[model samples]
Target: MVTLNLVIPCFNEQEVLPETTRRLLTLLDGLVANGAVDASSGIMYVDDGSHDCTWALIEAFHSRDPRVHGIKLSRNHGHQNALLAGLLSVEGDVLISLDADLQDDLAAIPRMMAEFRNGAEIVFGVRHRRDSDSFFKRVSARSYYRLLRRFGVNVLQDHADFRLMSRRVIEELRGFREVNLFLRGIVPLLGFRTAIVKYDRHARFAGESKYPLVKMIMLASDGVASFSTKPLQWSAYVGGVLALASLSFGIWALSIRLLTDRTVPGWASTVIPMYFLGGLQLLFLGVIGGYIAKIYAETKQRPRFIIERTL
Candidate 1:
């Protein structure tokens, strides 16, 4: 049997640690006994600079159970970086990443491992349905995935960070060094044989969601910027269309004044065009600036994350 490691990123999740640990430990024991995974397999909790007793709980769990390990970041590095930190923390045959809230069904582990054993290098634990999500969340998530697909970005719909990746996959992933890392988009680009294990997304066991609307929007923007330059191309398309319209308008205006003694009203024409074109120019500039900023960040060559301690 091959070893398995669970890398969970926790951000101020003190309330859910006890239950999450209990369930994971029980599941680990069952998997070992059933020969699905080796006895040396363990769970690693990544403490993403939690300002609560989250690290304390993890240390306690580590003392109680040797299978439980922890990594404390020097500061909060967001979920994606923290997940990456966990993935690089240990050497194992199979690694799985899941959120600390336990929203990803833990019951899907056996099937995911089964798929991995059957020669699939990556197993994505996809959400078969999201009935528990709010209507706004459902709509926004659908739109996000569809928009990425339209831009030719390969990402699995209804799949978050819950998935299994082989050791080779992790090694290849380490070579991808980018300031704004989008694992969902990057993983699919690796061209591995992957399988999907469908499971229902459950409500958080405790505490509120870490990702609010603003964060979600920022994440979507990062994903788009990391994967495709379609947004920048769209700006050029808009500029071309705007230029054509302006030329046609100028011709009509000149003809009206030459053929008749009437002039296009100054405010009715100039004022509206001024505001509309100005707005479009700034919006397009912002899109261009986003890519430039990403380039700026990469040129800095700063460390992706800082680890304070580990166990």
Candidate 2:
């Protein structure tokens, strides 16, 4: 029997922790009893510095069943890094990542495992329909994926971080130590057999959504910057176009002055070009700053996350 490990990264999810653990344990037990997984199959929870009693609850669960283990980060490392920490610590034939919120269905684990048996190194649990989400969220999510693809980030169309990965795939993922971890983008780049299992995402059983719009936007931006140079290229292209436009405008102004002996002096003549040039300069600066920020972060050579305690 092959051992399977489920890596769940959680923050302030105390309200949902009990139910999430119960469901996962039931699923794992069923899998083991049915001979789908080895008796050693287990779940590992990584607590990302939750302010609530999330860590304590995980500890209680670990005490109740040795199949459940946990690691507590010293500080909040965000979701992606916490997931990475859990993945790196666990040893298993196959690994799966799920949210603590329980929005991602654990019932799909068996299906994901079956797909893994079919030779897929990575299996993404994609949401077929985000009916539980608000209209704004649904639209934003769709737009985010489209923008990612347009910017050259190879990510699954409707996949978040819920997925199964073979041990080898996990090892390869561990090689990526960048501070800004956009897992959706990085996982697809692993170049292995992959599959997707579609499921309807449910609303959170308890607590508010961890990923609000602002965080989602930040993640998307990080995904683009980490995986693609298209933004930098676009910056250069825009700068070039602006320079050309400036030259054209200068020529037109000079031509009018010489040919028609006309002096066109107004806010339109001065302010328009000034605004355009100023905006262009700011845009270039922003693009440059983005690249510089990443460079600065990398140069520090800090660990992606720090683990305070483990069980």
Model 1 lDDT tens row, 1-311: 79999999999999999999999999999999999999999999999999999999999999999999999999999999999999987779999999999999999999999999899999998999878888999999999999999988999999999999999999999889997988999888887899999999888999989999999999999999999999999999999999899899889989998999988875878778778989999999999999999999999988778899999
Model 2 lDDT, residue 11, Cα: 93
* Residue 173 lDDT (model 1): 91
lDDT of 2 by residue, 1-311 (tens): 78999999999999999998899889988999988899999999999999999999999999999999999999998999999999999999999999988889888889999999888999999989887878988898899889888998888888888999999998898888788788888898888999989988887899998888789888888998999998889988988998998899889989999999687878798898899789878988998899889989988989988999999
Best by TM-score: 1
* CA lDDT, candidate 1, residue 223: 94
Structural similarity to truth (TM-score) of each candidate:
0.98, 0.97
Question: What TM-score number comes out for model 1?
Answer: 0.98
Superposed by TM-score, candidate 1 places the C-alpha of residue 116 at a distance from the truth, in angstroms, of 0.7
Model 2 TM-score is: 0.97
Provide backbone clash counts, one per model: 0, 0
* Number of the top lDDT candidate: 1
CA lDDT scores, all candidates in order: 0.93, 0.90
